[model samples]
Target: MSCSGCSNAVNRVLQKKEGVTSVDIDLEKQSVLVKTDDAVSYDDVLATIAKTGKKVNGGQVIA
Candidate 1:
């Protein structure tokens, strides 16, 4: 996710997914941080990656 290509790929696909408020690519941590409203569904996230021809390695939120 930190690679420019990965970031660009995610951005290109996420831009089309609804309710995507922002995306942050952290090269140092090698992670893609995505933020969105409650309207955004998990399937939409998966679909976005699918559209981008990339796979979501894994993700989870912690309180």
Candidate 2:
């Protein structure tokens, strides 16, 4: 996630998912601040990250 390219790519993928109100991708922080609904499950996030060869976890969601 330190790489800007990877961060942007992952950000783009997350942006496409429904229920995701908004997202703040920070390469420096190595985190993605996502404002989403309950429908946005960890699996949904992981799948989105997977599209960019990255991975997502429950704890990473910020809730």
Candidate 3:
């Protein structure tokens, strides 16, 4: 994200998701690290991120 507001908006949207546990945003890297449970899926996370009105470059699942 570009600024704290942007990150906060994203964080808020992500945190509202069912299984989201934590959200870490690195503005310099323009990346967000989200921790979630099995109740959340990769696509679901992507969709939720999209709801923040940000362009998602890409995303992956980390074991």
TM-score of each: 0.74, 0.78, 0.93
Using alpha carbons, what is the TM-score of model 3?
0.93
Comparing 2 with 3 on lDDT, the higher-scoring candidate is 3
lDDT of 1 at 58: 81
Q: Per-residue lDDT of 1-63 in model 3, one digit per residue for the tens?
A: 799999999999998898999999999999999999988999999999899899999888998
lDDT of 1 by residue, 11-32 (tens): 8778777798888777677777
What overall lDDT, based on C-alpha atoms, would model 2 receive against the true structure? 0.80
Q: Any idea how many clashes model 3 has?
A: 0
- Global CA lDDT computed for model 3: 0.93
Model 1 scores what on Cα lDDT?
Answer: 0.75
Name the candidate that leads on TM-score: 3
- Clash totals for all candidate models: 0, 0, 0
The Cα error of candidate 2 at residue 31, in Å, is: 0.8
Tens digits of lDDT, candidate 2, 1-63:
768888889889888999988988877768787788998887777777888998664455453
Ordered from best to worst TM-score, the candidate numbers read 3, 2, 1
For candidate 3, which ten residues in a row score worst on lDDT?
A: 51-60
**What TM-score number comes out for model 1?**
0.74
Task: Give the poorly placed runs of model 1, Cα more than 4 Å off.
Answer: none
Candidates 1 and 2 compared: the better one by lDDT is 2
